[model samples]
Target: MYSTIFSHVGKYKKEAYLSPLTIVGEVLMEVLIPMVMGLIIDHGIRKGNIGYVAGMGGLMAVMSVCSLCFGALAARFSAVAAMGFAKNLRSALFRKVQGFSFANVDKFSTASLTTRLTTDVTNVQNAFMMFIRMAFRSPIMLVCATIMAVRQNRRLSVVFLFAIPVLAFAVFFIISKAHPRFEKMLKKYDEMNGKIQENLVGIRVVKAFAREEDEKKSFGENTNSVRLAQFAAEKLVVMNMPIMQLVMYASITAILYFGGHMAVNGNIETGELSSFIMYVSQILMSLMMLSMLFIMFVISRASLQRIYEVLAEEPTITAPEGAGARARDGSVRFENVSFSYYDDMGNLALDHIDLDIHSGETIGIIGGTGSSKTSLVQLIPRLYDATEGKVFVGGHDVREYSLDTLRSQVAMVLQKNVLFSGTIRDNLRWGDENATDEEIIEACRSACAHDFIMSFPKGYDTDLGQGGVNVSGGQKQRLCIARALLKRPRIIILDDSTSAVDTATDSSIRKAFREKLADTTTIIIAQRITSVMDADRIIVMDGGRITDIGTHRELMQSSEIYREVYDSQQKGDDE
Candidate 1:
């Protein structure tokens, strides 16, 4: 865990090293104070030297103050370093996730990713701070105190030998029981986080259905699981506290009795015995800090394993070696392509169906649910690999182009619209950082989003809630379309993008795109028949195969699937 955290300290190497150095310096000062005290007791006070005692006492006080100064600074440095490391770690993880293909993400759910980014990172940060503060503190103090105690009186130091083993066993026992519990606790915490994410995201459904009580019960179940795991782990820790106290008390009692025997029998000095008791206190307290380190080790070990899981995973779809050349033409072709998910091999997503979409031409895709409409379009962006065949963009295999270059030329508005919490202008700028105000307005106008956006008091600068929850479904869709328009990519994929917009608005958006974006290749995947009725060409898909291909009127006459869909939608409109 320590090594993994060390690796994550990239770009913060200066702070990471300096933070620990300051902490150790502070610990050294603290350890010095006690040694000075032992010296003062044995030399200054024993010889009845008042000046020596006062001078030593003043020096010790100065050392204490120095320790405080170093400690305060180290704490500030440590906190700053920890936060910096965590921020970098989160960004790194998010980038890693972005590079991953859909298949890579399929291995874990959204909830698990959330846990890795949030709870897991927090665990590492906390463990890092604790390790920096306590890791060296206890060992240095313990070793120094032990040497001083033994030096004070050899026989009295024997107490430490017995006390040490007892403390070690107390730590080992709790750690063994607590390690698995902490793992379980983290899992439960993920469940709790997942429950909250689900409920908050679907709160409208919960309310509309009037199932608040049911939702509460679901939340309570997840929360209870977390509570139980935490309680079990803490119980073991709490139990160890009492056991450690018993051992410390017993050691103290033995030390007092035996040290008195040493002083009375002329084997040890009175002031020396005082130092032994203090040394004994340091030893026992040191045990407590060491135990905490053990628990932290358990937590960090688990978190490190999780972090390693992501780092070690190889993204399945990586560009081939020396695959740097890119073409300006955005033509896409699928040659004898076949693909399937990991678990369900028999359930092929796309099979041996060839497709060629010309550059600067509009291609509309129509399909039923699970007809591979989105899957086929996602291939243009190389979000996944064809399981058996090849996907070519720009007259070369997608794997031939650099990943960044290939993706840069393609703009895909997902079926599920998602927006970050930012102003309309900010979101639009994500598509094109150098986009001017006029360009942004032009993109919004083309997406049919300009009118509604201008209606708001703040217009494009208005604050949006997370995922654009403040906006209506149709508004979010239009904003997403505008964002894609701002990108000005060679290829634009509308994956059921205008579903939320009314038919008239959707038509206006298509007309605007047809006029302004004639040079760009467009792939329109829609559920509604009317949505694709005016496209230059339409491909009807059924069960992952291209069943029919032609213009809307041609397919409507020749394709039974298309005819049934048109009739069904026409009847629904009449009703």
Candidate 2:
């Protein structure tokens, strides 16, 4: 666990090492001050020597000053380390989430990822800071206090021995109980996040259907469950105070009773007994720190396990060796291809698919929902591997080429794509980092996004809200296309990309694609038969199989499914 956390903590090791050094120094000073007080009382006051008393008192004052300064410095270092580690860990986790495949993302929803990257990371950071700042200090004080108490009087040290077992037992019981509670509480937290996220993402549908009450009630149940779990864990932690107070009160009573008897009988001096009382207080305080740290351990252990889960999952689609470079003209083929998501008689997402996409051919794929249209094209980029047959790009098996090299040759506009919260220019540059102003404008033109973008007050520099929430659906889709256009990849896949645009605008975008991207191999996935009606060739799919592979007129004459679809559309057009 420690190794996993230190790895994610990226670039903070120097700060971590520096923070502990300050805490160790503070611990040393803190122990020395009490010892100084003991010597001042025993030698200076008893000798009736004014000089020795004043000198020792001044030295004690100096140690107190040093302790205050160093303790404050140690606290500053710890705060710096905690905040820095939290920031870096959250950043790295976000990067990991970005790189994860669709299957990995499906394992945890958006809200759950947010909570893990945020709340869980903060919990671990707090635990780490507490451990570094106080864990070491407490142990050092405990050991030194014990030695000082024993040296002053061995009988007094016996009180400490009795108290340690009680303290240990109390900590053990609370932590063992609380550890399971913390894990349970975090699970409930994830559940609550998942529900709330679902409600928010589909809030429009909920409101449209007047199901707000039902949604609220559903959310409330998860929320209440989380509240109860948190309350239970907190209630357990709260017991620490009262339990430690009992130990503190009992230890004090034992000290006063035994030390007073010793002082009265002259078995121990009055000064020595007074000094032992002070050390006993320090000992109890250190035990309190220990108990609090145990509680921290319970919480952090749960959080750390959650963090390690993400770090440990290796991406299944690894880039193959000797596959760094991609060919300039990207040719793709599916040789008797079949793909399934699961092993046991699952519905084939794509079945016995075969096709050859020449380097610069403008191909279109049209199908109804669940036709395996997107799945077939997605394999070319190696987003998902074929289960039973080969998918080749650039004349090599896609799995044989590096995932990155294959992807670099392909630019795809997904069905439901997102835009980050940044300027429009930033979103476009994600496709090609070195794109010039003219290139961006030219790509935007081909995507039919330039006019809409220029109409905005800030034009290309306009800030898009999260997922481009401020933009309309059509605008967002066009921007996604513009992003793909900026890359100018040898192969482009338009996955129902023009669905949001008007028919006239869709035609205009296609015309622009022909004019500007003449030499580019383009695959258009469309549900509207009109979008791909004029392609050089169209592959028509039904269920998961390609039923027709020809130009529109050829398919109309040869394939029953295509004829039926074309006849239905012609009737709709007549209506």
Candidate 3:
């Protein structure tokens, strides 16, 4: 775990090393100050030697300044190192997540990943800063101060030996109990963030249904769970300071009592006794710092594990070695292709599907809900690989081609349209980064989105709010269609992408596809019979199987499922 996490401390190695080394200098100065004070008290003040007192006092002032400077430098370096480490770690994690297939993303929820990238990384960053500074300083200070005290008078230093074990035990016990609670608290944080995301995304729906109070109650419950877990973990950590103080005061009292008697009996000098007391404080304070560092480590251990899990995950979908670089054409073939989200044949989403689609062929697929309409098209782009059989695009197995090459030729407008927070022109540029304004306008016209866009004050430059919240559903769908059209892909799959538009506009968009994209393979997945009536061929799907395949006239006479759906739709339109 240490090696995995510290590997991201790439460019910050200089600051990482410098922080601890400067801290060592600071600790050395701190340990030496008490010794100089002892010299001033014994050889300078007691003997009425003004020159010696003045000289030692000057040395003490210089050491104090150096200690301060070292401490400031350590803080600067450690902060830089910790921040840089976190930046690199976050970048690596994001890159890994981007590489994950849809199946891999399903294993980890969006909310959980968000929490790990943010709160978990922040926790580890803070712990690393503390480790470089206090973790290094405390142990060295403890050992050095103990040695100095033992050298001054070995008998008086025995008091620290007894205090150390008791304090260490208390710290260990608290940390062991608190670690699991912090882990639980982080999970609760994920839950809370999930609730907040859902509530915000569906705020309009919640208000429309008058379910605001229910949402509030649910959010409150999540927050309360997080609060309780945090309280439990912190309650244990809060005990560290008081226990440290108790051990500290008890050791100081024992030192003064026993050493005063030794001084009176001429066994230890007053100056040496004073130095021993200072060393005792230093030793106990170092223990306190160690306990704090241990507590931080205990809290950050959970975060480290979460981050490591992300870094270690290999993307389930990756190009093979020496994979083909490009696709030859838009033709797609599913040779006994079967797919299941769970990778179990019993739960197959597309069962043993076999079909051949030629380049520039406009195919229509009409299916009821749960018939896996979206699942079928998703395979063409290699979004999710077929569980059992081959999915070929351009006569090459999709796996044989690099992902960038295969996906760039296959553009899809999914059932749920998504748009980022950017200007309309900026969003459209995602399809073709260097597309000219005339080309963008032409694509929008084909998608039936050009007129609506022109109505807006900023036209193409209008900003679409996050997820395109500012636009109506139909308008958003049209914009998404425009973005995909701009790609000018060989194969464009519109999976129920026109559901939000009226029939007239949908028909016009289909006409535009036929006239403008004569050479592009167009696959339309629709629920309405009219949407697919004019296609070269229409596929009727039921229960994850292709029940019938034929043209509109042939299916109307031969396929009962297609005839029934078309008749019902016609009857509904008459009503």
Q: Which is better, 2 or 3, measured by lDDT?
A: 3
lDDT for model 2: 0.84
Give RMSD to native, each candidate.
Answer: 2.6, 2.5, 1.4
Over 335-383, each residue of candidate 3 has an lDDT whose tens digit, in order, gives 9989999999889999989999999999999888999888999999989
What's the residue-level lDDT of 568 in candidate 3? 93
Judged by lDDT against the true structure, how good is candidate 3? 0.93
Task: After superposing candidate 1 on the true structure, give the runs of residues whose Cα lies further than 4 Å from its correct spot.
Answer: 1-4, 11-53
Candidate 3 residue runs with Cα over 4 Å from true position: none
Candidate 1 has a TM-score of 0.92
* Candidate that scores best on TM-score: 3
Q: Rank the candidates by lDDT, best first.
A: 3, 1, 2
For all candidates, the clash counts are 0, 0, 0
Error of 3 at 468 (Å): 1.3
Summarize candidate 1's per-residue lDDT along 1-575 as a digit string, tens digits.
35644677777667667777877778777666766887798899889889999999999999988888888887887787788888888887898898888888888667778888888888888888777667867787778777777776787778778888888888888878887888888788777887888889889999999999998998888888888998988888787778878888999999999888878998877777787788888878888788778878776777777876776778998988888868669788889998887635587998787988899888889889999988888878888878878888888888898888888889999999999988989988989999999999999999999999999999999988788888999999999999998888999999999999899999999999889999899989998988888877899999999999999889978999999998999999999
TM-score of 2: 0.92
